[model samples]
Target: MKKWKRSARLVDMTRQLLDQPHRLISLSAFADRYQAAKSSISEDLAIIHETFREEGTGLLETVSGAAGGVRYLPIANRENATKLSRQLCAQLENPDRILPGGYLYLSDLLGDDRLVREIGRIWATVFSGRGADVVVTVETKGIPLAYATASHLGLPVAIVRRDSRITEGSVVTINTVSGSSKRLGSLSLARRSFPEGARVLIVDDFMKAGGTVQGMIDLMGEFRAEVIGIGIMAESQVDERLVENTVSLATVTDVDVKNRKIAVELGNLFTQGGFFDGTNPD
Candidate 1:
């Protein structure tokens, strides 16, 4: 193999780190791959680290010792997060998005790859230090968001199914009420999806009265898993929410179907101190 020059090596290294966020890569491996000294690799990493921080892209953490390595953490600073939230809010405020029964259409936004990935990055940044072992979401619409977030966190995604599937083998099921519709529903999870006492981060496409999210929380209890955090792409403004302490990227403040009007704003994520301010208390 041809020895890679410093410039080429830096580009390749940056790609590797960004491609696999929250994963540790040893300097020795890079040194061997590039046919360069460990000191040279360290310098290359330092440059990448500085660029990532200055650009608000993310952070590189160094682990020292015999088993030491560099880990890339994908986090967007407060300014970038706020900018993204505002942009999404603008997109969501279209009058055409107003649906019947005071719901807003979001399938297009959730289906967009670029938008979903960015939202995933935001959620990952907010919950990075929560010691999450897996990202959990209900089947269907929330699956993409869950997988995107799990990719950034280097964790597996565990999906809760509305109905039990035979392929999933033994499963645990729970019953809960929908806060908006006030209808009883059941959610199930595979027994082997995660280990007992796992710390889970729940991600969902939308939250209306927080019923679905609250159901997921109840399902987690059946497995003896801990709910570390909950992230929603969008939430509706309601007089009362079934669940509390959730991070949302955007809020649907109003949806006047009769008048064909809609309103959107940045959610509690901005008003909430820790995540919005780019400081995580864990």
Candidate 2:
């Protein structure tokens, strides 16, 4: 058996909690790991929890029972979240982001590892305690955001594809229509990816009219899954919105292709959600 000094043990304990968010770790387990007494372990945990709460990084939830343990919830501070949202809006307002079709380019932002991780932190914060068993997203563009959120939530990612592939082993596909152009499309999900009756949190990079988000909701129905919440990195304005109860970090109000101008603002995240101001509603 190996034992660590109190300071060394504290560092490792904090690292483990951060790395395995939402995972319950028993007091006895930590005691055994460090060859320390349960009292020592409890003190260490209290110290860590206090620091986390003060920093607004997260809080440690203590479950009481013979099988009880502590779990880390990766929640962010409202002020930090506000700063991030403002940065996203500022970055999105650049006229250079305006595309020929009046769409804004987001590849640059999505490619930034640090920015993507921070965005994932906020999504995890907003959707915390929703009883989500998995993080769901569409194929390709939404993959990164989904995985990032999953990492913070300690959940797996399930991707819905545009076309069913045989390699998926067994699949379910459904037809959907884009609310933007009224274009018809098909979405598919592997049957083995997640079990039936699972609870899911949908995460995506962008949304317009929410047709794709609607398609994903339909796909979840096939698995008898319940959608706890939806998180979008950015959502664009549309005349006919197709989905509701979505939280977004930024809102693209207008993209004038002829004038080479774009208008962006903070999304509905801070204004409306169960996690307004980064506090739990329940």
Model 2 root-mean-square deviation: 1.9
- TM per model? 0.95, 0.95
TM for candidate 2 is: 0.95
199-243: candidate 1 lDDT, tens digit per residue: 999999999999889989988998889999999988899998899
lDDT of every model, 2 decimals: 0.89, 0.89
Instruction: Give me the overall lDDT of model 1.
Output: 0.89
Q: What lDDT does candidate 2 reach at residue 195? A: 92
Which residue pairs collide, candidate 2? none
- Tens-digit lDDT string for candidate 2 (1-282): 776999999999999999899899999999999999989989999999999988888889999899998998887788778888899899999898887677778888888888888888899987888889999999787888898899989999999999898888789999999999899999999999999999999999999999999999999999999999999999998888999989888888888888888888788876645355455432
Q: What residue runs in model 2 are displaced by over 4 Å at the alpha carbon?
A: 272-274, 277-282
